[model samples]
Target: MTADRAAAPAVTAGRAPAGEDFGVYLVTDTELAERHGHGVLGVARAAVAAGVRIVQVRDKTASARDLLALTAAVAEAVGDRALVVVDDRLDVVLAARHAGHRVAGVHLGQSDVPAGVARAVLGPDAHVGLTANTTRHLVEVAAMPSGTVDLLGVGVVHPTSTKPDHPPALGVAGFARIAATTPVPCVGIGGVELADVGPLRDAGAAGIAVVSGICAAPDPGAAAAAFVAAWDGAGR
Candidate 1:
């Protein structure tokens, strides 16, 4: 039973769990800073202004202290309007919690903390999510311990410079196939642009996760709004 539970589905529904809708995933990088002249918090503020339902902060390079500070700033900016998610750092997640951020969740990649461990450490209320870019990983997500994660970042939907080593971009057909198999809210990440959000949503993405699409746009708020509009129109 223990072994079986360890592999139960993270999200049972094929789509986003209720109320989990279109979102903007933020990844902090030098390009984002250079282009926007602000860090993750600035992007989150813009996204929220543009009606983003959720925000995931993914900073692969920030130190734990830097991430914690950023997370606090992000939480303050988002306030009660948007769900704030920290990227692959459990310690940061804990720090956010300790700081009374009421943060919504944490998103982990394949090599980050184990989902079960994360669930246990994050407690039962905090939302947990994972990245899965392949059909095999989708199947694995479907079999993850139930309630271990609340959503999935499933992509590299198109070839991206962000994760250049990520397996081939899962084009429309591949997106559909993976979506069909994933029993979770699958958010399309990697190379998503405002123009692509609608189609990606149509391909069964619960939301679109972006880096450059929003952060690097001339006006991050407007770019995020466009994605929100596109997702709404896509009917996904």
Candidate 2:
């Protein structure tokens, strides 16, 4: 049940069509999964079954080989059910793709390879997302050649322990301010939860990205379902 990468529709700045809801994005946390006695792939599969539309595999500590193996496993598990992306590791994404895994793209941070180089390597069809913590970052993204990137992962909406290096919490108001100015779809990450979905949507976020909210939960399936329910109820 691998996804047809060539046939997947593009996600522009505007809202996605119904059923292609990118409204609930899940970022995997290996540490969180370990704490809950679950493997990352298992949690991701359960989450996708419960309606998560996008899943980003982000493990800062795993070696390239381990990350590639994990990415491939996740691709097999949820490739048909959701968009499978790698976080901060374009090399892993490339390796996975070369290995015939159904990886959709990579989510890069400001310190990662520049978006232009990433786009050139990934080609036009691969989904490319970048993190933006300030208005300047958004402005830079907006100024990039059109189609250079697909979406913006705007963050630290609340203080999150998952990434100790995260910038200051943006809060909803700050998130709103940044989202309003971006021309691309934005997903609010860092400390987000089911309760924040509606307000995040109202603040112009195209989706909500969570780590512990689902991965650390006792029931990842139900947790992911709750997020989908909240997004659907938000009418975004």
Candidate 3:
């Protein structure tokens, strides 16, 4: 991580609903289990057991048909245990809704549909999040009058395999600068790990989005627990 990236307060790392201090950011990795050859449902179940409150299904490569099927299955696995979200593709979001899937919302990146468009399609109940890499971008999106979005993702705090083309890591300080300017809850993305939770929460992030940190672990449930513990300990 760059010097600026390291200087930001860890946002998602400190608090839990129970008022415990876990010192780790909330885990949000739905695609990581696929890397280890675990089925989507299995991975999601493991994540919920580990205290993950949210899951984002981000399979860009999956065909539309396959994506919907996978979404349905993962949604079933999460089943009230976690808030399941679909990444990008509003079509999948629609399909998930139609299938009686318990999807909580959609996460949109820069190239995906605009937040207003997504809100129109998903209706009033779904949660929407936007990705902002710079202060300008963050301000532009956060200041929009639409009021369609529920949250923002503010960084690749460090290099991440999940988004290879993402710009260089924003590190901690850059994240704090961007996050400090936004009123919406922010989640730090990219290269997040247990150790980074404390600083991330301090930076004002509502949570941390992770991929390999939990997915790549030998025991995903344990990994998930560790992440939650870290975030809770940080006083988020």
**Highest TM-score scorer:** 2
Candidate 2 off by > 4 Å: 1-21
Ranking by lDDT: 2, 1, 3
Which candidate model has the greater TM-score, 1 or 3? Answer: 1
lDDT (tens digit, per residue) of candidate 1 on 1-236: 01121232333112223554545555544457566676667777877777675677766777899888888887777746666778888888788878888577688989998887888877777778888876667767767777777878887888887676798888777777887776677788878776776677677776778778777878878887787677766763
Instruction: Report the C-alpha lDDT of model 3 over 88-138, residue by residue, as the tens digit.
Output: 878887877887888766789888888888887777667677888876677
Task: TM-score winner between 1 and 2, please give it.
Answer: 2
Judged by whole-model lDDT over C-alpha atoms, candidate 2 comes out at 0.84
Report the alpha-carbon TM-score of model 2 versus the true structure: 0.91
Tens-place lDDT digits, model 2, residues 29-121: 999998898779779988988878788999999999999999999988888667789999999999998988889889999999999999999
Runs of candidate 3 exceeding 4 Å displacement: 1-32, 35-37
The estimated TM-scores of all candidates read: 0.86, 0.91, 0.85
Instruction: Give the Å error, residue 48, model 1.
Output: 0.5
For each candidate in the order shown, give its overall lDDT on alpha carbons: 0.71, 0.84, 0.70
Model 2 weakest lDDT span, ten residues long: 12-21
